[model samples]
Target: MSAKPSGSETEIVDGGSVRRDHTDRFDLRALYETSQLLSSSLELEFVLNNLLLTAMSKLLSTKGVALLFDPLGSAYRVAASKGIAALPTGTDIVLDGIDTNDPMLEDDVPERLLEHGVKLVFPVAFGHREIGLIGLGPKFTKQPFEERELEFMASLVNMSSAAVHNSLMVEELKLANRDLDGKVQQLNTLFDLSQEFNATVDRKRLVKLLTFALMGQMMVTKHVFMIRSVTGEGDNGSNMHIVTAKGVRKEDLDADTIASMCAQQDMVLFVEDGDSEACDHLREKGFRLVLPIRQKGDTGAVLCLGPKMTGQTYQPDEIEFLYALGNLAFVSLTNSYLVEEQIEKERLEEEMRLAREIQERLQPRELPVMQTIDAASLALPSRHVAGDYFDAVRLDDDRMLYAIADVTGKGVPASLLMS
Candidate 1:
């Protein structure tokens, strides 16, 4: 079967007659039916079943196995088998110390195969490439397989080799498509979550959404969100603190453990199956994931998750979704922080304006505005709002008293003191 000269096509050079490999076939119609049935379907199992049945009927064998080459593993595994209880199906075989890819029979077949009741070990090749092996036990009549029977088996295997290769390719294609669809659906989900996250600007409410998303999507219960202070926290500092948490008590979250992870994962960290000490420590604490939200060039916040309720390892796409979610959280939190800061700045500005006005009122605006001794006065502090006091008092008709004093400090406080 393996790129060897076909037995039926051989010519006898030593004798005047050419002997073709022949079997006691009823007619050409039976061979035609065998060919048509095996070629009818691209289903590997169906093809293997019909092929093995045809072999057993033609050769009267009681045990058989269809071994197909797995290209990825570079080994042969049993695809189908029957009546061979001693041989383990589904386990790959290396042919253990075999020399040739050519078909072997009788004493030439390896001893290990002999132990498994393999009377015939032939390769099924398509064009120039051998794709599989056919192993058969001794015939039920206890007779050894004849050369003619082996020749017929080879023809049947060759006819089905093309179908077998096609079926394997189709199965691999189906798996690849399924994986792609899963990733695309995951992306669509992340896109929708991003929209929701952007619309919410309140940090507390945004955190709640993030928490719910993780729990609902990942089926996680024990989790914490450690948000680094936007104004002060950084990879070099301990300003990161748990802003929201569930299941885990506050006391159990060690500060050093949290800070160490923050420093290590400056951009992002998915803690599943990592060998680093920080990752190991986190895993030991029952936390399986840590995602740090990037703000500027540092870690702005982090979300740590415990073991999933489903108890499954995180896939690549799920980890990617977490990265997307973290970025959305970063933007929302930063916007909320900026809005609060601006509001506080405006409030302080308003208070300063009011204090400055009070200081102006305390000054002698017109210096009595009277014709008593042609008196004149002016007062101006060296700063925007300062503590300074000066006044002139007219008594009766001819007496007058002028007073001046300086108060401590500046800005709003000093202006209030001057009054």
Candidate 2:
């Protein structure tokens, strides 16, 4: 079937000319179907591809392309292409003076488009802004476009622009929702870790929980944990001591290396290509991130780990979460140490009280009476048991000896000696 020129009205002909109402009916029906198809989906790619295909088939063009405007940036890229093999999708091209006012012919189109073999350019526009462009090659008839054809094409593009803009907005909203979900999950993980840590007093158990939380949340592969002191012993003037480690070679991060890390007082990333020797050294030791576990503004511990198991770099937000967990670990451990010290002090005080009682019992309650001599004894007990002893002895009828001795040291040992 072909449609040819018939005065001011178009006609449909099979073997002979048809009336103008039939052709009008056909075009009206086609436009209705095209509107239905374009409004069917919110998927940007599907809508653009279908729109371009419909336009090319209607116009009898061999090639067509759709370029979408990037709402977040100042660039336009090819979104859909047909019957053109050399053009690359996502390639950006700039077209100046191509306003959203109306559809443009090849002469009115930008000169830059000639290189892409585009003959017709339609601005898919809505609300005074162009959201996309539809480019079409020459029609198969190789004839100039009629006024009615341009008007129809303009209507098609104008109607589809709103749908395209809505689809792009929907995609942007989905991406924002996904990003918000990730942040929420990260916060939940940190909160859970903090609760578990606050309940924990044992250093080993705390480290184990930290490792599990870190690996579960951040997908860590290799890590080591260090504290300022261990069992209050073997500090040997060093500030940091390694408590536990995994996947680390010996001589890589010793007490000296940890001291250097603590000196920074902030999180550090070891870059393999860094200009600093210290960072390069850390990188060579398989450490990608080092964090200080601070308590009361002092670095009480350190945490070091390699790259994520998935080989992704640690993001700033993830590192901040690690910092928070690290500080929580330090505070928990410090509280445990304080509680242990308090208990030890209380035990020592109780022992001193018992020792004082025993020493009092060992001393004479009253001095013996002497018929010919007057004698007095004074005993003073130290805050800790001092173990002082005194005795009045009668040797024969006329001889009396007074003896007194103070023992060395204090507490239970001195109290036992006095007894």
Candidate 3:
């Protein structure tokens, strides 16, 4: 027969089994809510904050902190916190992987967290590596965390770690794309300048265009342009003359300073130490960079620039391109000067030939003969047209007069004066 309970006795019951069923249902609901909240955003900081808040709520803890690992520095930094005032953000700690499942069971929790009253440490792991840690104070109910609750916390972190890592990767890709776009823009600017430089030959206009292009590209306001001073018959010279200047006193760029800069074959920065007096003068004039324009192993020109208006230092690639463009402009200016010289020489030579022809025509082809007495004349010409002349005049009876004269100067002017 089945046993029946007596009125004073209570029937046996499995209270532990009933409690386990209730706890399982509660844990499932909490996990579902945590997943939904964390997966709603791709922003790392937002995800971290939400994760900490959810963990604290589920565990009934008063304090919580999230520390994310920075692989570059090989350390973990506090990324998010709640309810703990003294746990400042961005605090670094070095904690390796642990075999113990519960942080409270570990022998060595970092003192930074221990001193802040952190009682539990949970690893947020992804793909066999720990990416961060979650620390929490004691539960509000003063109840010890069960095995099921710790396991559920680990599952929650695992799900969120993947999302965090993916967000970081996306951010890196965006930065790389921006850098590439900047490079392409620089290349296009250089190509346009090259086309303009090819079509330009006027010295003044060329310098103006070059200056404008450099100022616009580099974002600089102060500049000085120096080109070699060509005199006499040849295109080469060692003297450098400043062609244009702005944002600095022109007199400050003295002769000796320019000469010293023109002697250098490479770009130089005017710093505080180990520089010559000329460089010091440049610094005083607010010039930060000096770039040489070399022709045939000698500096034919130089470009001086002040600090960038954008407050950024010039990169190596930018300096290299400026050097190349400066040299190109120098060559074009030199060619224009040579062409002008040749044109002037040709024009002078043509005028000299015309003057000689007019002088020859003005003289009598043959001297008139006088019957009473014999008269003779001879003419000799020099390589250059000198305004020397000889003429004969006769009066009817038996008298002849011979005259000679020389005019000052040479070529056309002298010939016209003589005439």
- Residue range 116-222, candidate 1, lDDT tens digits: 88888778877766678887878898977776676677777766677777776677788789988988887888788778777777777888888888888778868
Q: Which stretches of candidate 2 lie over 4 Å from their true place?
A: 1-38, 48-159, 230-237, 249-251, 265-274, 347-383, 386-400, 406-419
Instruction: Give the best candidate by lDDT.
Output: 2
lDDT by residue (1-419, candidate 3, tens digit) is 12335443434446433211234323566677777777777777888888898778767788999987777887888888888888678877776554334455334566667778787887776776656788888789888777776776777777777776675566668878876786677678777777777787777787777778678777777888778777522122336666677786666676666765666544555444327776776777777888887667766788888888887887776787777777777777777777888888899888778867777777766766888778676555563466778887776567777788888776556766888
User: How accurate locally is residue 27 in candidate 2, as Cα lDDT from 0 to 100?
Assistant: 72
lDDT of every model, 2 decimals: 0.73, 0.75, 0.72
lDDT of 1: 0.73
Model 2, total clashes: 0
Candidate 3 lDDT (Cα, whole model)? 0.72
Which number leads on TM-score? 1
Q: Is candidate 2 or candidate 3 better by lDDT?
A: 2
Q: What CA root-mean-square deviation does each model show from the true structure?
A: 7.4, 6.7, 9.0
Model 3: how far is 361 from its true place, Å? 3.9
Name every residue pair that clashes in candidate 2.
none
| Candidate 1 residue pairs in clash (backbone atoms < 3 Å) | none
RMSD of 1: 7.4
